[model samples]
Target: MTSALAELSEALANVELTVPAAPARFLRLEFLEDAPEEAAAADVWSVTLDVSGLDAVPAAGDTVGLLCPNAADEVAAALDLLGAESRADRPCRLSLLPGTTKKAARVPPHLPEHASLRHLLTHCVDLRAVPKKPLLQALRDDAPLVMVAAGTGLAPLAGFLEERRARGQRAPAWLVFGCRHPELDFLLRDELEAALRDGFLSRLDTVFSRTGDRQRYVQHVLAEEQARLARWLVDEGAVMYVCGDAKGMAVAVLDEVVQTVAKAKEVPVSEAKKLVQQMQKDGQYRLDVWS
Candidate 1:
């Protein structure tokens, strides 16, 4: 990444965790729905929390990191071996995958000596904006959008679309999601299809790779839908948002988007690549990917 691009990403990205000024409160977690996008991939669940005791509840697109208590369990088991003074509050860092566009925050020691399993759970928020901030913002003006996601990366975009629908926004949008299996891991399948039914989502597409002999991905779906994608970008001025595995899915999807631009404008591949870079610089092409 260029220095300028790195700077822009840092300026626009933030990670906030629940602080230790006050002891953490235990809130109930409610399971809403689970949308499996891939059978072998992690399942994306739409769960609701009883955030009544929290200082402030995380809004849509915000993440809640549930810190495991295994370490705490070990600590308690050895409490007799280690004296009280040795048990001084220690901070735990919840690190996300490292990237130029990413950062981490410490999980505060916000619990009592006998903190329970619930107290160990922490909330790591993205204070600046959700990964799909640009797409959500575009809905305020009802701008056209193209959202592409794979596996569990569908969480933020699904939340954004749900919020838009709740607010009665009529932004034309397309969703191209890729996963291992639709039946087992098509997260938010019902909600997305409902959005399409109600006219909130302009189009919806899905790819299940493991279901067939050939391995297909979301980028393949993007290539198949290049005509619509080209029109969305070159003609309608639609913004693009991609969230998925950075190593493979995100890279391939980006290549296809750039190629779509080049094909639509009949420009050299180099020029098209630059146009994609410019879009990222301008925050029109946003990505939230992890290895």
Candidate 2:
């Protein structure tokens, strides 16, 4: 071989190749709760992904990192940044820069080493699920659980209930879910009702915010269950988890629980808050929230 051709052949021999990760499929999307025809599809669409390509089976309470389509403005800005405005759909391969790995980089960690950018977006990267935050965990079989949430915040908690069913409900659990109205956007109604019937849930309380003359919220339910809440949290070592809107719902529920503890123990509200904080520190009370 010519010297230059020999060098080219050697370089080609040194190159590495790998099969790309298999892509996950969109399995189903269910309209949840009760909502007007126009609103049901828009407001309460629950998507289920086919993640069999994943290396690990997602345990209960896991979340997939989904990369949604960028807004037009975002796409335009990205194209401008790269000076590749005309090449938005250009085929491209994906690879880590030097000194980067899946764990350290923003790319989905489980993606195959070899994949095109288009393939990554369209087919791959959908099933990349990691564990939930340490504080928010899968349902444990050993203890009673109190779950509070509003709106679609019930999604992860629903996973917990399913886990309870599949694993054989060992401990009693209570769910307090709030939504706009019993007839509009009270998500997962059939399943939740079935859960109650099958003993997957020991109790299920729902509060509607925008229906009757007297509106109710999750905190209202908590306020009425004060004695039982205290017994669950203090006496039976039950775990309490609050999820959903941080600005309003979560704050209200926290306040209500603190008041319940204070009333039960005959302590000041300040002391009760501190006691509740201790429960959090001890991993008994947990929160997963967003604004």
Candidate 3:
């Protein structure tokens, strides 16, 4: 039986399998028993197999196939040897066994060309990890800062603000977050309100594009508070951080900032642009952009 087990092990080792999704299942199964139910039913006969080699990457919602039935039998035999009870009439279905793949969470498709900018912006600010680093770094700089974020882009900004508050670093911070509707689309209203209540954030200006008579955005809010924003920029050496869709929101915010600086400081547009460029060179102006 030991010799047979050794042969089975060798055979199983050489077997190949393909999974249809990301290989998180194989990674997770490393610490789990091959037959958890059997292991629980008979502790003495329990077996745990380390089948990490079967890991494979596949697209979400794809199917996989195991080419070798003999290898599966050997694996089952190994589990059975550990006292895993099996019904001889209905052996475990190989196809039904957990695959080495995993399906990623479903995400909406990218906005179509004909979609409204508001719709595109709404879906652009995914709260995923790819854009968190820059946002967090900007928050940690401990200087007067203006954050402009539109649509779901507020997600990472919210995370950055929360992290700064958690670290007890309450440097004067301002947020200008724009969305389609304050009532229907506010992403982090509670958190922003709590920060305001606790004095973590100095000011929050919300612009709702579809609210009231005229459409408004973060850029509009910045324009409305040009004097205050200019004071923060020129007097306090405030940093500016913008996060959101890269297509229109970023460009529009930058243009609005330039215009606001020129109008408020009574300087030429070129001078305002140069001043913003200098701020960027000095690490006072940072952008975390994503499509």
Candidate 4:
């Protein structure tokens, strides 16, 4: 694999300190900070360089190859190392080599095509060409849907709501979101409230854990609404989607969901577990979980 540092060096060699391109614009550079635990005494910085120079701009659902001079040189070096470019007068294509490095690029609907926001809300909301087809398809069906998210996890859920609205489908949807604080940490509160006002969302639940003396999370709210959740699951074939904080919050919420299902239905715990598992396998329970 080509090292990012080496690629940076090559980029410095080819391009001036700053150059302008009409079709492909150079975006800002981003330095990602390491997690608090990872950089106890020092700091870890991750740099992301963004550019938009392509034949056509990508759409929300589209993926495109991000090619640049540095990446091209890296591929050329690797090809030469492998003796793949030995032939004379042969045009070398950067993408032909198997191990060539090009960044995986996704087009974000909300972000300006020419500007880059590093680790910010716009950057996080950009849709990439990832394996979310299965999850999207699962949510496309006409069923009651419960979307649980934290922090930036609301991005995709907002996208899903936008998709439904565009298609003129009145899908029954509920959102249960947990954040650090209601006023401070809420990511898409205005947009969600607009959707609610438009009758696009049937219910909206917000949990702010740090606001109260005792922490109250989305799982606690789910427990409080156990009867409603259970009825939706059984009667309307409701699908549940959980996103964000895979290790602590997602796991805790899943445990609470299982317990709530068992308690509300008055079913054996084993049966409730089976039902939840079946729902997952059948694509009725979906997760876009991440840290």
**Top-lDDT candidate index:** 2
lDDT of each: 0.73, 0.80, 0.67, 0.67
Candidate 4's TM-score reads 0.57
* Residue 232 accuracy (lDDT) in model 1: 89
Error of 2 at 61 (Å): 0.7
lDDT (Cα) of model 1: 0.73
Considering TM-score, which of the candidate structures 2 and 4 is the better prediction for this target?
Answer: 2
List model 1 lDDT by residue over 6-44, tens digit each: 898787787555676966878888774554443266635
> Which ranges of candidate 4 are over 4 A from the true structure?
1-135
lDDT of 3 by residue, 227-266 (tens): 8888888778888888887888898888988887788778
Cα error, candidate 2, residue 38 (Å):
8.6
Model 3 lDDT, full chain set: 0.67
- In model 3, the clashing pairs are 20-58, 21-58, 45-82
lDDT of 4 by residue, 1-291 (tens): 469889988888998666666677668877864333323222223233354765564322232334222344444554466565554234322223455565664444433444322212222232233343334443554778888887766766777676666666577899999877665567767888988888778899999766656888888888898888877877688888887778877888888778877887789889888878888899777777764
- On lDDT, the stronger of 2 and 3 is 2
Shift in Å, residue 87, candidate 1: 12
Candidate 2 lDDT over 1-291, as tens digits, reads: 699999999999999989898889868888876545435333668798898997889877776565655455555565577677665566665566887645757644656566544444445533334444554568557889999999988988999998988988758799999988677687999999999999889999998877677778999999988888888887898999898888999999999988988988899999999999998898888888876
Query: Residue 87's C-alpha lDDT in candidate 4?
Result: 48
The CA root-mean-square deviation of candidate 1, after full C-alpha superposition on the true structure, stands at 21.0
Per model, state how many residue pairs clash: 5, 1, 3, 2
Q: lDDT score, residue 88, model 1?
A: 36
